[model samples]
Target: MRIAVPVFPGSNCDHDAYHALKHVVGVDTAFVWHKRSSLEGFDAVVIPGGFTYGDYLRCGAMAKLSPVMDAVRRFAEGGGPVIGICNGFQILLESGLLPGAMMVNESLRFVCEYVHLRAETGRTPFTGGIAPGTVLKIPVAHYQGNYFADDATLAALEERRQVVFRYCDPSGDPTAGSNPNGSARNIAGICNERGNVLGMMPHPERCSEEELGSADGRRLFDSMVAWLKEKGK
Candidate 1:
């Protein structure tokens, strides 16, 4: 499968995502600049982590207006799979492609470390290969990674099974202490109502290889590719 990784000024993790998909996951991938208004020929798109637009006007707020994001919104509306990591998740929220908003870490500090994520559901393409309640070791790097939503929104997400992952202890328990950021309900990741678009704060590309201390993140990419192939056939 072919993947497009959109690159914006200050997008530091674009290359890492490209490398993970191209070399580590053995998929065709390309870097799509933020100014370009096309996402043609790509089966999936990844908005990688980084401080976009220098995190000005709030994280992802400025980047959401980029020309490429217009195309990305179109792609997602057409049911094309889209995954946003870290600041990218913030962009999705800003663009109205996903729910909720990001807040400063409750600790008021930049958090850069590996955390365990429990797969809440396997219904979405991004997490289909992962079994429910499975723990994944992934890294998160962001200052404004805390996720928040209204009670009604959270209830709807739970009802639709759109909450794909949650911050959890190594043993798979989602508790207050395990939440790296003060996200509502310990949510680490979530998908849209249609299940095609996903937004998560963790950096899956950083740990897609065993040499990097874990290969658990590969399952997410693999699941997306597998779903694409299945749909194509």
Candidate 2:
């Protein structure tokens, strides 16, 4: 399957994502400039992490208006799978493709380190290859990664099992102390109601290699590929 990795002016992780998907995951991937108006011919799209547009105004506020975003929205609405990492997650929120918003870390500092994430559900294409409650060692680098949503929205997410991942301790316990960014309910990642879009604070591409300290992130990409193949996409 062909994957499109969109590159905004300040998207630093676009190359990393391309390498991970193309070399590590062995998928056909290419970079799509921010000015591109169409996302046709791509089976999946990934919005990698970075300080888009210098994070002006807010983390993803400016990047949300990129010309390519319109196509991203249309692609997503058409049931194409979309995954956003770090700042990309913020953009997804800003574009209203996903619910909730991001806030500065509870510690009021930029957090960059490896954190444990537990698969909250295996029903979504993003996590279908992993077992529920499986803990993964992934790295997160972001200043505004704190996820926040209203009580009703959180309740709806929980009710529909849309919560894909949650920050947790090594033993898979999602305690307050394990929440590095103080996301609500220790949330680390979530999927849209249709399960076609995913937004997460962690950078999975950074951990998809064994030499990179861990290869647990590969499971997520593998799950996506498997799901797409199953659907003949």
Candidate 3:
């Protein structure tokens, strides 16, 4: 599998994302700067977690207009697999690669720590290895992670199984109180209508090692690599 991880001015997690793919998954990974205009021959792309552009202009709003995002948009529209984590998720929303918008945390403060996420979709390449209701303990760190959409959109997402993860407690019980940033319906992740584009608030690469207390995040990346291999065969 070949993965392209984009790096913006303040994209602190790009290296970690690249490491996870290169070391944990043993795949060919490259760090692509935001100025680049095309994605070349990569099979998949990961917009890693971080405070891009210092989160200066509403989380990912500023980075959304970066030159590389045009290619990212093209990649997603072409049905290529694209995963956006945290700020990357925000960029997807801003770029219209995915639907909805992010808002300030209900508490209006930054949140950072390990949280629980329940898998809500299995049809996407990103979550194929995880069963429905599979509970993953992953780390989430962000300030503007709250997700919001209108009633019709939310209903459509639920009806289509486009929602991929919901915030929950360690016991696997969904709870708004457990929500790290007050995402609507406790949603921590979602996929585009076609299921090829995914955006989530949690950092999967951060939990790829057992030493991080959970290896659940690895399953997401592993599933993508395996899915690609299967497609090739």
Candidate 4:
């Protein structure tokens, strides 16, 4: 199956994502420019991390208005699997493709390090191969990574099992100390109600290979590939 990796002006992880999916994951992948208007030939899309618009206008505020976002929105609405990483997640939030908003880190500092993520659910296209409570080692690099949601939305996410990944200790416990950004509910990743769109702060593409100290992130992409392949059949 073919997948698309959209590239914004300041996107630094587009190549990383392309490498992870093409060379590592062995999937046919392409880069969709920010000005592109259609996702006509793609099966899925991955919005990689970076300082979109130099992180001006509040992270993704200005980037959300990019022409490509409309296509991304249309693709998501059509049930296409979409994954947003770091700043890309911020863009999705701004585009209303996902719920919640991000704030500065609790430490009031940029966080850049590998952290453990516990899979909270496996029902989504991005986590179908992971069992609940499975801990994965992935790196996260961002300043505004703290995820915040209203109590009602939080409750609904939990009840619907849309909370896919959570920050946790290596032992798989979601402890307060393990929360790097101090996000509400320790949420590191989540899916929309349809389970096709996923957004997370971790840089999965950077850690998808074993030489990078961890290959756990590959499993996330693998899950999406498997789901798309199965759906095609």
Candidate 5:
């Protein structure tokens, strides 16, 4: 599998994401520049975390207009898999590739640490290897990770089972301590209606290597690769 990791100004974690796939997962990976006009020959793409454009003009507001986003939108519409982490998730929201919006942490702080996430749905390629209700330990670092959506949109997400993951304790229970950013319903991640595109505030690549802390994130990439292979796509 080939994974495209987008690199824009201030995108410090792009290489980390690439290494997770190339070294850890042993998958073909490329660092795609944000100015690029196309995303050809890539099986999947990942928008890694970081302070894109120094988080100016809202978390991902400035990065939304980057040249690569057009290709990303096209790739997603064609049923290509795309994963957005942290700032990348914010970018997806800004790009309108995913629903809802993100706001600053309820306490207005930058949180950085390993967080527990509960798999809320089994329908997405990103979580194919993990059964529903599985617990994953991943790192989340962001100042604006609070996810919010209107009541109707939230209801629609629940109806379609698009809510893929949520902040939770080690026991997979949503609690005040497990909720990192005070997101509505403790939502940590979600997918589009088709389930090919995923946006999450947690950094899965950061924890894919056990030495980095945990291997919980590895299943996410593994599942995606396996899913693509299954379809022979």
Candidate 6:
């Protein structure tokens, strides 16, 4: 299966996503510019993180207006798997592909470091290969990674098992100290109700290899592959 990594003007993680998919994970992958209007040949889409449109106006606010997002919406509507990381997560929220909005890090500063993420569910394509409660060591870097939603919406997400990951300590306890950006309920990632679309603040590509000091993130990518392979059968 082939993967598409969308590249916005300031998307620094585009190469990182591409490298992880094509080199580390041994999957066919290609870069898709933000102007492109189609995702026809791709099996899955990964929007890498960066300051799209320089995070102008608001984080991902301008990016939601880009032409590529329309195609992404259509692709996602058709049940194509889509995963967005960090700034990409912001874009997904702004574009309405995912629920919730990003807020400034509770610390009021850009946080850049490794944190543990506990898998909250394994039903989604992105987490299917991982066991529930598995802790992944991934890095997150952003000033607005905190995620928030209305109490009703948050309740729905929890009730439907849409929450996919939560920031946690190594032992897998979601606690105040383990939350890098103070995301709601220490949430680090979540998926749409259908589980085809996911947005998260962590940068899995940054830790997909042992050389990067962790391979835990690779399980996420590998999980997507496993899901696709199963469907293709």
Per-residue lDDT, model 4, residue 41, is 83
Model 1 lDDT, full chain set: 0.92
TM-score of every candidate:
0.98, 0.98, 0.97, 0.98, 0.98, 0.98
Give me the overall lDDT of model 2: 0.93
Query: Residue pairs in steric clash, candidate 1?
Result: none
87-134: candidate 2 lDDT, tens digit per residue: 889999999999999999999988999999999888777788999989
lDDT of 4 by residue, 82-132 (tens): 999999899999898999999999999999999999999888788899999
* Residue pairs in collision within model 2: none
Candidate 6 lDDT tens digits, 1-233: 99999898888899999999999999999999899988888999999999998999989998888788999999999999999999999999999998999999999999999999999999899999999988899999999988999999999999999999999999999989999987889989999999999999999999999989999888989999999999891
lDDT score of residue 170 within candidate 6: 96
Candidate 6 Cα outliers beyond 4 Å, as residue runs:
none
lDDT of 4: 0.93
**Span of 10 residues, lowest total lDDT, candidate 1:** 224-233
True lDDT of residue 181, candidate 4: 99
Error of 1 at 3 (Å): 0.8
RMSD of candidates 1 onward, in order:
0.9, 0.8, 1.1, 0.9, 0.9, 0.9
What lDDT score belongs to each candidate, Candidate 1 first?
0.92, 0.93, 0.91, 0.93, 0.92, 0.92
Clash count of each predicted structure: 0, 0, 0, 0, 0, 0
Error of model 6, residue 128, in angstroms: 0.4
Overlapping backbone residue pairs in candidate 5 total 0
TM-score of 4: 0.98
> Per-residue lDDT for 96 in model 6?
90
